[model samples]
Target chain A: MQTPNTYRAGPDPDGHFGLYGGRYVAETLMPLVLAVEEAYNAANADPAFKAELDYYLKYYVGRPSPLFLAERLTRHFGGAKIYLKREELNHTGAHKINNVLGQVLLARRMGKRRIIAETGAGQHGVATATACALFDLPCVVYMGATDIARQQPNVFRMKLLGAEVVPVHSGTATLKDALNDALRDWVAHVDDTFYVIGTVAGPHPYPAMVRDFQCVIGDETRSQLHEAEGRLPDTLVACIGGGSNAMGLFHPFLDDPSVRMIGVEAGGSGIATGKHAASLNGGLPGVLHGNRTYLLQDDDGQIIDAHSISAGLDYPGIGPEHSWLNDLGRVEYVSITDREALDAFQLCSKLEGIIPALEPAHALAHVAKIAPALPRDHLLVMNMCGRGDKDIFAVADHLGVKL
Target chain B: MRERGYWLALAMSRIEKRFAALKAESRAGLIAYLVAGDPDLDTSTKLFEGVAAAGADLIEIGMPFSDPMADGPVIQAGGLRALQNGMTLRKTLALVRHLRARDADTPYVLMGYYNPIYRYGAEAFAEDAAAAGIDGLIIVDLPPEEERELADPAERAGLDLVRLATPTSDEHRLPTIVKRASGFVYYVAIAGITGTRSADADNVHRAVSQLRRFTDLPIAVGFGIKTPEQAAEVAKAADAAVVGTALVDRLAQNLDSAGKPKPGLVDAVLADIAALASGIRTVRK
Candidate 1:
């Protein structure tokens, strides 16, 4: 019933991406959300703001991260040529810094002295803490109690950067609970605190604003691929949790009909077993964290805890824009189980000497499946969005390595 | 137009009547909230009846969710207990119907998040809730901007959808909220979650006065009016004062070491309600 181009311009003035995204929060947060919308709009149009963002992205966070050709991976697949967009080389060792720098600058411009964020794997928390330290702003990061225990290194990283890491014990003690606590903190301290939402989710201005900040990945990839391959790649792949990295890599290429987009979701044990974080593949659309998105919930509409070996992908919901994209048929969403992701983690490490995070290992698993069936001339770009240094202990434990 | 007016009047009459009676007595109405199946359903039902008998002008039954973001630890624990006791949306409506059979005059509001009703199907939920004699609803997560998903159906079913106004709701946004809001305006006395901090009476009075300038809708102050003294302070300015966490805490306090209801759990909660009711009544004296 709709054209292919219908997916390009979404999230109308009211922030509804075809009934998926809207500001579904309490009245206590309405004014603050509106203020953020206004400030983001003004900053978006100001050339000076863009220039400053560019400066930080290039000098501080290290932009234009190399597009490394994974020749061994291509040979192992025995099909398409594979290229890895090395976002793992960024300052914070992940793609999270790209958006954090932009948001911290915007928060500074708005005269906010305190920064608060919620994290699952500690990658976003580390990135946000890094930005806050650079900007001289006091920072607080909320992490789940379970995550704090599992992700001790990230907890230490946040503390080393002078940010307080509060362990949330409410609900399932996961990313969703952490986000709820952060929103509560924001509501209580709206006057002085800026909530740096880690993903491309949350209410209006958040999903869109975060995507705009992250689209640099796709923007760079378009030119880099053209210069290297003489044309756009046939397919793009990235893992989806709150879906920031996937949205970043998918937004600028939405209009390129020749380039297909595939978002990989963590299937945990498996989608069939019901213990998974594959929101689009195994869940339904419902409201949570201030927006309507695909959420893992019971039949009674109570949210269920998402399970994944990777902390970053252990979230019950995905981004609202991903919901819109899935509904519009512009992007294909698939799932990979925990076993498959772990296998890919080892395979990628052995084949390319690139230790991919469990989050992107889901994407690698899917790529391994589909790439082998495609023609050799076909080009596939997968976002190596995060490094696996933080995941070594978990992976080792799972593999009986006794790290 | 006349039919619309009739529906609006009929939908609003229960809330209006309670406020009118309180006005005649020169006191604020007491709104009591209880999780539907705290500890167990039959006990919560008994507690609800006791609250009405103890002089609560209106009642709010919380449909417990897995995650209650707006609630404090006391209320969240109550919700978890209710869920563990097998409290579901259908059972909550059944509980309301049972209560309605006993007392028909008290305004009953179902307060919680929106997902349960969304899963129940909005139109079906409205029909069933209206059939169950539910007077109103206060979904904490469904703001005015996203109300149409449930508001239109609720209105057609002759159920009032109350809106919450907080300290952050400035003058620029009050008009839009007041226009569509029915039943009453729930003013969160504190900027924080339920039961965290008590509201300053003077600040509450100023906020209520500001809201009064926009709409004639009765203002019911909630969120941190925990004790009798706090309720008395809020009663001076607001038409009604809502108490949730204090009553929930009473139920928790009366429980045994194993979390089971002790002998006087219902009585203890009712006695607290009676004290709060008497406290609000002192605004007249």
Candidate 2:
């Protein structure tokens, strides 16, 4: 096990990600966002706050998840050595709980009584609901009607955790609609509600805050790779929805120029077919849901609805940091179609008994394509963001293997 | 009516004259909905002219946001269709500027959500919308408490912040909603989505009557109003009737067989809108 590296940098001074992010929100919410920023800046510097969070990580949520080297998986793909950061070992079976614990703890310190969030695959909602239950704060989860029907198990878990689940029925009834509803709720109750935004998307503090909490992934991965192989991995890969888990695992490796980082996004069919969620591939520069990122939009700037077998990655926009990283050449984004992700999902499951989430399966698919070309001496670290229990139905339906 | 001098004054003097004429009319005002650019830039100019000529008192040009939440499936589909046909805010504003060259009186209201406007910056958007002959704006997602963000810039640009009020607005909030609203107070008939369907006239009348007691400004009832009879029922109690999804959906439905081109659909929709307005007045009388 390697120690966590705590290095903090950000939004330049005006909450901007290399001209990609700014406080583009209603004025009524600006003061609140500014307050949260100020609070985060103050609390992060506080030794007592850091101690509290560190204690929880060690005792409560079980931090320092294992870094495993997959020998068979690497030889099968015929690519670089594969190392997996086992975030799936975390409580709640995904990387989502890591950030949720951080945000929910921050909400407690801020003296908030109500917590609200939006979820797509219900991973974040369940994580948030778990946090709220632990903290004894009221929790409300807004999920798109479509997602509620798809991710029924997670929805049930949230309800069992005593969170109110509001089904959003507008605009394709998916993640975007749930986001809109959550934003409306925040606006209406800004004074009382601390919106625990699930992903690194939203206006200002959210993207930065979520990234900060998630950056532990990168911090752990960096030290683990250095200790295990006597040097940092040559390449890193992770899936991008709103780019939370990818950013979490990518941030610490950012300054390591030799360690090439790749972010894989879901392409439902193909970019040419115009039915994919490849925001970084097929999208133009635009603002949606508070961040100015690459959005899958038409010529008129109307955001196009996205399609993905993985509900978690079914969004039309990527995180602002990903946009900035793409523009700065710090990261390269690749697309893995539904078929490709399915193939990787099965490959990982059969070879290593590691049933990867549909999201990470996209990254694994990208790795399958690129690994065969890289030298054997080069090592690749892929963030196993979540488990595949939530994706069995989608996989079975897509493969026509009646289960 | 005089309170709205801020946004109304920004309009060219001749255009202001046309707005005044509609204020005097007893015939339930013409409410027009146009997706900023339909067929192309050239077709937008024709659509504006056709609607104006067809007795449209107020034209609500859809400024095409990427994600329009308040819109019904019909309007959302229409907006996507328009966007696919090469419509943009820049092109939409250019259409407004183009319309100003010929007609100035029919009040042009750019309707959409806040993301596109915020992305453009409120001050810059207000300045550009004003320069392009847009008289007012109707951002659907902006709650009443947050109106000041757009209101200050719009006031400076001499454009109205056309706010929306729902049946659920409490007694205390009604006055504030009316206080901030200009041109007219859009009374959402129900507490649901935006679409075209028959609404209970008694329910609409009660909502409008309650709003009428709070503000003397024209209380226009809208949302899901489809037929002429429904329009007449809403018009009998409210000062104006605003129909959106039905007209936009009609254009969407009458598109070219291949779905690529929808030439002359705007004109046909405008004609139907004019008929709806006239039919409402005839039925009410």
For this target, which candidate reaches the highest DockQ against the unseen true structure?
A: 1
> Which residue pairs collide in model 1, if any?
none
Predictions' DockQ, in order: 0.76, 0.13
Off by over 4 Å in 2: A1-8, B1-60, B69-109, B113-132, B135-285
Model 1 DockQ vs. reference: 0.76
Of the candidates shown, which would achieve the greatest lDDT relative to the real structure? 1
lDDT of each: 0.92, 0.79
Can you give the lDDT of residue A356 in candidate 2? Answer: 95
Candidate 1 C-alpha lDDT tens digits along A51-107: 999999899988889988999999999998999999999998999999999899999
**Candidate 1 global CA lDDT score:** 0.92
Error of 1 at A164 (Å): 0.3
lDDT per residue as tens, model 2, B1-285 = 657766666653433454355456655565767677664556556667788677666788987765765555677677766766777788888888888778756778888876667666779889999998888888775655445668999989889787677755657667766777676777777555568345678888788778788877667777868877778777778766778788877776777777744666766787788777776666432
State the lDDT of candidate 2 residue by residue for A271-297, as single tens digits. 899999999899888767766778887
lDDT of 2 at B5: 68
TM-score of chain B of each: 0.95, 0.88
Clashes of 1: 0
